[model samples]
Target: MKQTGAIVSVADVAWIIALWVNRSIHSSMKTLKWLLNLDFEQQMNETEKIKRAKQIAIIAGVFTAFVGVLLLLNYLQIKKSDPLNSLVLEKLVERLSSEPNNQQFVEEIRQVDLLMRKAYFTSLWQVRTGAYLMLLGAIVLVLSLRVYYGLRFAIDQPSADQIKEKKKRQLTQRWIGISGALVIILAIMSAFFTMNHLRSYEPEKMIVHSKAGDESIEQLEIVSIRTSETEIDTVIITESTDVEVKQPEVAITQQPEMVVFNEETVKINHNAFRGSWGNAVSSSTNLPTSWDGATGKNILWKTELPIHGYNSPVIWNEKLFLSSANTSKRVVYCYDRNSGKLLWEREVNNIQGSPATQPKTTEDTGLAAPTLTVDGEKVFAIFGNGDIIAFDLNGNRVWAINLGVPDNHYGHSSSLLTWEKKLFIQYDTHSGSKVMALSTETGKTIWETVRTNDVSWASPILAKVDGKFQLIMLANPNLSGYDINTGKQLWSVDCMSGEVGPSPVYGGGLVYATNEYARMVAVNPKTGEKVWEDNYYLPEVSSPAYHNRYIYIATTFAVVACFEAATGKFLWEFDAKNSFYSSPMIAEGKVWVFDTGGKAYIFESGSEPKLISSPELGEKVFATPVFADGRVYIRGVKHLYCIGVN
Candidate 1:
């Protein structure tokens, strides 16, 4: 069957080539007759001129025939090896061999056979169009040759009037050639531009949910040790099963108590202090400001440190723990929160193939982008390479686990969150992305759910939907919900554009997620139904912070917008002088926003906007400021500032 089709295609191509050659021969004959009628040609012998014209016509015809044969052979080869034809033949054979009474099977086979035939014809049409183009070029070449020989004959023995007319015709041909070239060039460039534009336009879609119940849980032993210069090493080894409680009680009651003390009653004092980066879970409150210096009356001491990072300082008692990294080295530094003095600095080994950042992102952007989460007994830090390290409050190394590589083209920015005895850290990337839970004590896998697409800069947020705990992950084209215990996909809503960048904020029963291409969407966490979507116009990389009835979103374009959390309605937008990459922190009746240019802007968190202060430090800043102990900790490119009234 294939051989038969090949022979037919060759015959068709041969016919087309023959028709093109016939038309060219006729046009060339007319030109030859005109050359003979010229007065200049009267000087030449009539027989000689006729003989030359016949020879030229024969040569043109022979060359055209040769080209036609080549085209026929090429078409035959293409038809013989076509995949579409093979598929069509296979389907036809299957249909003929089927049972006579099986009407439905016959129809299915017939449809497949029809589609294959259509595809084969379409492929053949494309080849025919290419051949047509060649035929057109051949026709133009034959015409040009006749004109060249006719003009040469006239030029060799021509009248003065003939020479003048020939010059005019040559000038016209030059313009035609130039115009044709320009048209072809423009068509090629237009096609390239259209393809480039299409590649950049990505459609917004819902997040995909993965099936759960496939993960294999493992048990691992964990050991904690306290080493001192004078005393022997104090080691504590606990059994994996005995220590692994279903739920840790420490997480439930650790929420800080909300105090309703008046501004005047709060006392302000500062002194040198030291502590580890233990978990200091503060209670959730709607108070605009929680700091003692809200009235600008209480004066507290301030200090600065040398390293800068995006990780928020975890303060336990007096000492502060934070991580910092540049292109060359990554360091975890301990600082005295009160005196602003460096206590001890430990350098972590750099992992190979880590994401590289521009110079502007050096401070807060590095392999140590995620903030450390502590559980009082040990401080845990997640590196860009998915390495989680644990240390005691006194800077003693506990245990380290290297979770597989993450899928982040920009870098891993998801911070660690602890729920009872489980440490939840999401590792979503361009390749092999998954969200996994680990035992906080033993570092053993609890449950893991693989994701379909890459979530470059977004972080997972834990939310309770309809009284059931679920893991909400912002991924490519969708917002996913997973069962907290079993890692099962509950539901997913498509409401994302471009790369997911913002960590989803849960408030008023809705999950707010934003992307770099400036799409903000709110969806019900339980049902995965979109509440509303707003185009911010400006790119948003920072997560939205919710307080009271409003959610604050900071964009990299230096604009901060406050929207009603329920309806996604814009309340007010503020355009600061510096671009904002840091998430806004609401405290003490104010919204604290740190900019990339090292300026911190404090504004009233209400309908009527009021700027409190925009303090400039002489360096760039990337990390958001954390308000604690009557002061704000601001991390700049070169130094970490403890900002407060002097």
Candidate 2:
């Protein structure tokens, strides 16, 4: 059947070509029949034949001249305005580098460039083609004028035979005129087909390129040192060091022996801002009950940061990681948690393009809005440009990959999370929203679930319900839950609206969802049912925190409110000193909320509005503070401060 179809297609194409050729031959024969006739002198007198030939030539020459002039003018217009420029070519190169593994993109780029070059050459040659046609028409007109004059100057007059030939000559002129019009029409049809063929070379879609202009990177170099060696093991320190020549290695023993390496297991504290659910707060431990950054009452150390971002810091072991970026560069900063000293800085080049190739952003949303994730082994960070990079504890880059440019309107703010060695990235965009699970050891995707949401800023939180772990997130008009291991939608409910910023908080057999201009709904994860919803005092930016039977919320306008977890009942509202962008945190029977004006408000967690103490940290704060051990790490616009009693 396939072979039959192939044969049939070839036969059809051959028939089309043959038909066009036959038409062209017939038209040509009719156009030049009078000139090729050998018996013209016997059939018609010279005077009569000349008169008829001049009329035919004059009409054909005028028609051909008009076509030639039209083609010449079109060619000149094309030369004046060409679309291919350096900027356009540069964008194509950038798009090529973005997805080097995509073969389709590579082929499309090649075809686009080839077509553009072909168009330039075709327009240039059209000028010469038109000029040649004009010259031919001019020669024909001159010959017609010569024939008219020679016939009129003859002295001998014609007889009755000449009078009869004059009528025949006039009839032949009508046939030639009909043939000339058809010839001109055929030329136009051929040109039309040629242009149609050229149009087939257009790309499937326009590919725009972006640049990370004037960006400078600071690549951190790390060195390893073997400090001591025992009989069976060695201790090594992975730290940043300068370039220095090393001595030759010396063997400790010459005899071959069996060695048993001891495997040690260490327990890590929940210190980082693990997803949107917040770090596990200790109920009985002694964290700082009160602190003041302006008076230096409990401020341990403050280190200034060069870059600016709203991304919160993540802590693993003894290091605190935070990501920041400008329009040109994205940077990850690692600092010593105890001393607030800068340990190492790693930078990645950024390309800023939004839903379209135009850089879409607002003053509030920046490049590094997503918080970093540290899963004990590697620290992962993602930028608005769809770059996901991972690094080990020693500041060495593990792997990097671009998840295709996101189509978010106000930058991507979906924070990353990890469960059982799989990195979960909530990549919700305006056009192609997906939940991807990647292998932590290698930056390879394990499974991906496409979503129908449009442009959400909420991050996903890991929740355990009905003896299985589920990833819960707030999307446009819905609060959905998915299986953590497999990208399967376990449950979802329509309970959210507007641009979602506050991630869902899971507790007490219910998950609470909130947004800027939407109702706050508490959803049951098992059945995907909305328990209760309220529209009063909805948070625009800050996420809700659940403690005991109450939920705490900090509005964007600096009003701190608490509500009943099970029922949609408003508890109380307090006016915070400044506006809040950071989410509220509950730890040790107190609710901690940071405002935009560098102030931290501490209050008792209850239905009544009671303000305990408001401490002012001199710098502007946009990130949520991390509380672990005895220190609270707050990431300000210009610094990362460790507030603890020394």
lDDT of each: 0.58, 0.67
The runs of at least 3 residues in candidate 2 whose Cα sits more than 4 Å from the true structure, single-residue gaps closed, are 1-284, 350-358
TM-score of each: 0.53, 0.60
Flag clash pairs in model 2: none
Write down the lDDT that model 2 would get.
0.67
Most accurate candidate by lDDT: 2
Q: Which digits, one per residue and each the tens of the lDDT, describe model 2 over residues 1-646?
A: 2332343344345434434433443343353355436775666777676666566565546646465445534433443444232245456656656655444554455556565565545544454454455445545554555556456545357678976886787688668657754654555544444344435333332222334531111122122212122111111111111111112123233444342211111113442343333433433245675667778888899888888888888876678899888776688988988978888888854312222232456768888888888776778888888888777666767666667677888988888887677788888888878787877666666666777777788888877788887888888977888777656677778777788888888878899988878889998998888899999988888888888899888998879999999897998998877888888877678888789998988888888888888888888888887866677878888878888776
Top candidate by TM-score: 2
**TM-score for candidate 1, residues paired by index:** 0.53
lDDT accuracy of residue 490 in candidate 1: 69
Give per-candidate clash totals: 16, 0
